[model samples]
Target: MTSDSAALPGERADFLQTLDTHRGFLRYTVRDLTDEQAARRTTVSELCLGGLIKHVSGVEARWMRFAVGGAPAMEAAEPGGAVAWEERFRMTEGETLAGLLEAYERVAAETDALVVSLPDLDRVQALPVAPWFEPGATWSVRRVLLHVIAETAQHAGHADIIRESLDGAKTMG
Candidate 1:
């Protein structure tokens, strides 16, 4: 009998592969960085390498909750308020690159597992309330996966720029 841990079928495999590729770019950008280097803000923007990893991990985890259980699930999974929100983009005291990366690996693994076991990518969830979201909009599990992929790719690009500025390191040409 086929099982959740078995090799995923085509579309699911493609999603996981694409997600991993972009995640690799982000991880590669931070290779060998010290916690201080990862935390340092290279540009005027608040973005930092470690913070991007933390932020992406949290985002993926939250959205995957949404994918499985809709908006309330996502909100319940997230830390609340402006301060908590702002912290996602900066490294606070005692936050280390290694710790952040480890957390990210866990989140990624959870997402990969969910994608494999989920029965219906087409199952829909009403999106959580936010100014950025359309009023009353709903998204399917497949759309959530797509959003996660896009978020990872976009943040990887941002991380690359920050890394290059930090020490002339580039994840790709």
Candidate 2:
């Protein structure tokens, strides 16, 4: 659950630490949980714990790709697609919490390696057309990493709430 980005100093370490803190929150929320438990929608939100993790993992992977390459095509498998959006909220058939967790760990490891090895944090990429994004925009890799961290943190909070509603477990307590 550790990130190599923490080994460095300055903004890199700070960013990694922030990301790790939230990742830890999410990891703890899902620990000791079974497939059924993770799949449970404890709150009114359609997002289950496993689904949240999957969504985050996929998003990080895509952004990492964008950082390394350019943005994907409009019809690509990016999350904005109708199918991807629906699948992002829950475990699809044959997907388990453990399996998704393992995949997420792999994605996290790759993302950390990229973050640490990239020579230029300022490398920028133009964002793809999306309703949620501006008509034309670009973001640096560093900004993308920060966005990942922020997203993970937000979902961690949601997971905490869902965990509490499920079995009265509180990650913050």
Candidate 3:
């Protein structure tokens, strides 16, 4: 069983549950794949499973740090930046699926910690300028958490499709 499966239910359990659900889905996406296969760009977009994992990790780190007034330690891609939705899904040779997944786990933990520590949902947080979002707009901690849930769920679906395409692997257990 995964660590998330061990969490107890409570008042804010939904928030933790959201994180765990997406984390589990992400984990299942790379389970049982060899390094080469994990890096394989099966999609026309050149998106590999390993790259997706890294992208998600970077995104979680950035958003959690943003919510808590801390600068994210993860490096961003030059032209597109971190969470570069287009390039984020693309993997380089050096990135193994295992490594990416481990990084993601670390980032997820950090995000969870930040979320749990925040006392106020209404606190304002800054978001970086990106193609899909307005520049300099502030977000609430609750808003950021909800956004994370949405983002992770969307990517988890993508990961499921990509993993299925790689092999006949279904039923992300």
The best candidate in terms of lDDT: 1
Task: Flag regions of model 1 displaced more than 4 Å.
Answer: 1-6, 77-83
**Which digits, one per residue and each the tens of the lDDT, describe model 3 over residues 62-171?**
67767777223223342234344565666664767777787787777766666565677789855665676687777887887787888878878887888888896863
The residue-by-residue lDDT of candidate 1 on 72-126, one tens digit each, is: 8888835433347789888888889998899899888899989988989999999
Backbone N/Cα/C clashes per model? 0, 0, 0
**lDDT computed for candidate 3:** 0.70
Work out candidate 1's RMSD over C-alphas: 2.9
Best by TM-score: 1
lDDT tens per residue, model 2, 1-173: 34466567787777777877888888899989989999899877899999988888887788888888867632356543455577887988888988988888888888777778889999988888889888779989998988999899999999999988889888887
Worst 10 residues of 1 by lDDT: 1-10
Pairing residues by index, what is the TM-score of model 2?
0.90
Cα deviation of 136 in candidate 2 (Å)?
1.8
Better candidate by TM-score, 1 or 3: 1
